[model samples]
Each structure stands twice: as structure tokens, then as C-alpha cells.
Target chain A: MAMAAFRREGRRLLLSPVSYNSSFAARSAILSYSELGPMGARSISTQAVRNRMKSVKNIQKITKAMKMVAASKLRSVQVRTENSRGFWQPFTALLGDNPSVDVKKNVIVTITSDKGLCGGINSTSVRVSKALYKLTSGPEKETKYVVLGEKGKVQLARDSKNSIEMNITELQKNPLNYTQVSVLADDILKNVEYDALRIIYNKYQSVVSFLPTVSTILSPETVEKESEAGGKLGILDSYEIEGGDTKAEVLQNLAEFQFSCVLFNASLENACSEMGARMSAMDSSSRNAGEMLDRLTLTYNRTRQASITTELIEIISGASALTGFSQSARATDNIQYRRYACMIKLQS
Target chain B: MASTAAAVPFWRAAGMTYISYSNICASLVRGCLKEPHRSEAVAREKVHFTVSKWADGKPEKPSVRSDSPEE
Candidate 1:
């Protein structure tokens, strides 16, 4: 939790939490790297800095790769959603126009993703569901939830287990198509009952912004009531049914179609938003890794130069006592070995 | 308002092709009645049939896993 908190605050903190852990690890590494005392151990600080730099560079590479993948995915999902707009909009006709929602007996469908690290997209929906439940569920009012995505299910299950009508973990596993959602609609229609079905999902407003949005599917009776409530003619009344099947069967199928369409749109929008969040998060992490690398390289060079200058001063002055200079010369040779070792570490 | 929705059974909506459905799953509610009286009659009918549908038991949630995702 602390690590997550640090990551969330990392943008303004302007550093990854790893920087703290890396520096601490490097301190311990310096103690181990310096087998000789400070005077003989010429590469302690430099070796530690080198290790830090390598890890930072590696992180940057990973974040860069993730950012690229997320960018391409975001683009593809955007196209998919745009292309499917024709399919989703027609079904909006099934939305109940009735203002008198049985908020008491509403079936709320919360759409979240199975994955995490994409920001607060999943948590926001869960929070809203909880708030709505707390506010409305009472003696005459009970709101059942159809939770889509593991993240949202886990979040909601922490508090309101009984309120959850169903949880779907696999909807966001792939680029989900209609068939997967069709079965979910069938399940809900075959099982759950409500006067109003409310679908809650994330809406991708822009590259950096997504908001939780709601769409509702009303019962046919509620639709009729809503239409009657409105003094003007209702739009849904125009969708004429002609099949030889019974009126009840037609309405049931229509409800299934509307339910499927709404579910499909919610999942698509949530996925698109999730991809966007990941892209932005990875882009920032990559940039932070670059900055840490710059700092580590600078620290390594300064320490190396300082160590070299101090050694040269000791060697030059020792020339004054040339009688025993041979013994001191051996000490200088150790500096050469240390430099060679440092170079190898740097290469690694 | 769109051609993606098939208003008839077996998706026999005229002029709209199956290709569109496969491409985007865009068509919906094309089979519903436009006349208020037809829907009114259906609304009257759903109350009686709904109980039987519920008695049939809920379709279980499938254990479908997502494709391997990024860490």
C-alpha cells in the first residue's frame, strides 16, 4: 500500500519509489564492494553508482516498451469503438425514458477492468456503486449489482457481497467481441430481475481523462410508464415488432438485445480508457527513469575523479621520501587494479 | 436508426448485410415493434412469462480467462 501510495504521488514527487530503494541498496552494496578500507578501496562509491545507473537504465527500457505497446493498443481500441458506434447507438432506443426508476429495486451493472496499474478507473466505479448502494438500499429498496471485471468485483466484494448478483472476470481478458457479452446478457435476463438496469462504466474523455458514465436499461413496463409520463410522444414506441412470436417473447428478446448492446459499449469504453491510463503512466515512469539515470551517472563521475585526484596527491608527495617509495608504489599499483575493476563493473 | 440492428429473426433485415454484424455487432433492436399498441400488448404479456424464465435457473458465469496480459 505504501508503495502504491508513493507511485500515485510519484508525479509530483517527481521520482520513482525505486529511487529510494535503489539508493539504500547501493549503500549496502558499497560496504560489500569496499573489501579494503576507505584509503585502499578506491572504487566503492563509483561502483555503487554504476550499479544504480544500470538498474535505472533497465527500468527505462521496460517502461519505454510498455508505453509503446499501450500507445498502439489505445489506438486500436479507439478505432474499434468508433467503428462499433453504429451498432451501439441504435440500441439506445431500448433505454427506458421513464424518470420514475425503481431506484429501490435497480440492477446496477458496474464495468471495470480485470487488470490494474491503469489509475483509479476501477476504484472510482466501485466507490460510486458503494455510495449508491448506501444511499438507496433500504426496506423497500435493494440494488443488485452485476459486476464486470475482476478489479471491480474484488473492490465491491470487500464490503457488499450479498448485493453482488454476478461477477465476470474474463470480459476484459482479450479484445472482447459481442458473443462474450451476449451470453452475459442472456444470463442476466435469464436470472436477474429489476425495474431499471443501470450500467456504470468508464468514459474515455481524452488521452489523460476518463470519467465514470452511466447507461440504463428499463423494463418494458417501466418504458411504457415513462412514455406515458412524458406528455410528448415517446421515441421507443416507433420501433414496431412484426414477428409471429408472442408479444412477451419479442419483448424478452428485445431486452436481451438492448442489454447486450449496452454491456458491449461499456466494456469497450472501459478498455479504451484503461489503455490510455497505462500509456500515460508508463510515459511518466520512463521519463522518471531517464532523470534518475542522469543523476546516477553524474554522481559516478564525480566520485571517480575525486578518488583519482586524492591518489595522485598521495603518490606525488611520497616521491619526496623516495627511499621507501617502492613500498608506496605497490599501493599505487592497487589503484590501477581498482580502476580496471571499476571499468569492468561499468561495462556490465 | 442504423442498419446494423436486425429487426427480424435470423437477421433478415433488408439491405443490411451480415458482414456489418460480424465487423462491429452494431445492429440491435431492429426486430422490435414501432407501434405503441404492439409494445403495450407485449408489456402486458412479460409479467406472466417472466416468472417461468426465472424458474429455469440462472445461466452460470463461465470461467473464461483473459489472454496473457502485460505485468
Candidate 2:
């Protein structure tokens, strides 16, 4: 009972110094239990505590640095993404977004980052791409994947290895530009034959939020068909061509230009989303590390104090026992002297 | 928009593929950007990498190549 009461008092004292709410007591208890479970039977030493603190501190430093780097990169990428919007938005407005347009052959371009440690952006892209594949696959409809970035390639290769038509990596080793992206688009266009090109990428909504978006570009033949059948391209008939180029040739050029423009814009947006996700991810990691460090410091202090208290108690109890033994010895001596005096008195 | 009525773009008249035409257009756009962004955009277009062609389920030897905006 006394030991339990002493333990409660010690906890109260420890909790008071930390100034955490009552809930922290339970949380700390859980944390300490989990931490101690793996090192069963061994007492918590201050040396071990210090080592763990050092490691956590190092990790916290790394996370903080990563967050800062991501933040700076996000600023630049955000600007580029905004600027690149002009490059693609006009094409979308001109061509019109036809998500439901039925096409025979489809090429799905999954855009993701080469590096990870960003949140779930890559996985989200892959998931959306997979969902899109399932939606678009049919008996007559053929679907192929052109995965961009190493991360998406590895993930998509796991399930749809045979379906991957092309995989491009190291595209983001340098900053993205229209020229670079156009070359990539041209390369893809030459390799894959698709009536409709579906580019899947993470669209940056904000620093903390992003949406997986699929933008489609229809081939010139498909556009002509839509124009004739659905009158979707009726607006095209009204436009005057200055170059003596036929409507078909104009549509062809527009389709190719629009493809590259949209690709460049999508890559920029994905890069922005990646940096933003990474920043937030690193920020949360640093915050969690701080909380962990606080808990560890508390446990370290508690362990150190307990060891000190045990040593002090051992010393005090040992000294008191010695003094008590001497007192008993002195009492025995008094009784012996008294007995001796009584005997002498009787003899007299 | 003013250039829309201009005679078919020079690249198109010169019998260039859409790739080279678009690249020239992109460089022209980059060249027209303001100071900081122009340099940044120009720098970004300077890409160097190794490209390998795969044949018979085997990758050919990779070769070092740089892709400049200027063809």
C-alpha cells in the first residue's frame, strides 16, 4: 500500500513538471509501456535514454531540413504550375473536355514523382489509374499504360506489367519545361497509338490538398468524327484558317500541340503537388518527432530520478541500521554493568 | 492571337515535324519571358540523359545524349 501510494505521488510530481493535461498521463503510460515491452527485464538506464534522445533529435533535424527544402521548392513549383496553366487551359477550352467520348484504343499516362516521402500522391495516382483502367477496359476497347516517373512505374508494374507500354523516369532530374515535356510527348505519341490519350496526374489544389485528375486528348480523326457526328467540333468550322491548311491538317496540328501543352502543364502541376505533399509530410513527421522527444525526455528523467531515489534510500537505510545496531549494543552493555553492580552490592 | 492569322508557321512551311515545330515555338515562348523566368526556363530545357532502345525483350547499350531546345 505504501509503495503504491509512493508511486502515485511520484507520478503526480512528474506530471506536474510536464504540465500536460490528465489525458497525457494515459498517453505517456501507453507510450512507456510499449517502449519498455521490447527491452524486457532490463532496467531503463540514463545512457540508453540519452542515446535514443540523440537519435530522435537527429531524425527531427533531418525532417526539419526536408520540410524547409520542400517548402522552398513548393514556392517555385507553385509559380510554374500557375504560369503553365495558360499553356494548357486554352487548349482544353478549345478542344473541350470529353471524358465520356468513346474511343477504340486508349493510352493512359500515369504521372507521378520519381522520388517519394511525399504523402500518398503517388499511390493515389496509381489507384486512380487502376480504377480508370477497370472502367475503360472492354472486349473491343484496348487500353495500354504509359507510366511516367519511376515511382508509378514500379507500382503499376506489379499488377499490370504486360499492359505498360512505356515507362519514363528521371524526367524531373531537371526542372520541367515546355521543350522537355514536348519532346517526351512526341516520343510517347510516336510509340503509342491511341484514339484518346488520358493523362492521369495529381492536381495541386493547395499546399495541404491535391486531387487526382485525368485529362483526355482525342486524336484528330476522333475529333473529326465527333465534329461530324456530335457537332462537338462545329465551332471549328467557323474558325478561319490563314495558312491554306485544310481543317484536318489544322486539327492534327492542334491535337499534337494540345497534347504537349497539356502534358507540360500536368507535369508541372504534379511536381507542385509532390513538393506540397512532401512539405506537409515532413512537417507532420517533425511534429511527431517532437512529441516523441518530449515523452522520451519525461521517461528519461523519471528513470534517472527513480535510480537516484533508490540509491539515496539504500544509503539512508544502511546508515540507520548501523546506528540502530550500535544502540542495541550500548543497551546490552548498560544491562551488563547494572547486573555487575547488583552482584557487588549483594556481596558487600 | 495576332500570330494566329500569320502565314503558316515557318516550321510547318519548312517541312518539320510537329515535334520540332512545337519545340521552336516553346523556345520562342521561353525567349519572350521576363528576366528571371526566361533564364530558369532556358536552363530547364537543357536536359541530358541516357536513352536505350529495347529489342527482343533486352535493353540495348545506353548512350549518353543531351537534348537541347534547339534541334
Fraction of native Cα contacts reproduced by each candidate: 0.00, 0.20
- Where model 1 places Cα greater than 4 Å from the true spot, the runs are A1-43, A93-100, A231-250, A320-348, B1-71
Q: Which ten residues in a row have the lowest lDDT in candidate 1 chain A?
A: A8-17
Deviation in Å, model 1, residue A115 alpha carbon = 1.8
Residue-by-residue lDDT tens digits, candidate 2, A1-348: 654554454435433433432334454456565675444233334556777999999999999999999999999989989999998888877779888888889989999899999999999999999998988899999998888887987798777877877777788877777677887777777778899999999999999999999999999888888887755666876678885776777887888888888998999999999999999999999999999998897777666444433433443344435455553344344434544554455445
Model 2, runs deviating above 4 Å: A1-44, A325-348, B1-16, B25-41, B48-65
Quote model 1's TM-score. Answer: 0.65
State the local distance difference test value for candidate 2: 0.76
lDDT of candidate 1 over B13-48, digit per residue (tens): 432223323323422242255677555433321110
lDDT of each: 0.62, 0.76
Model 2 scores a TM of 0.77
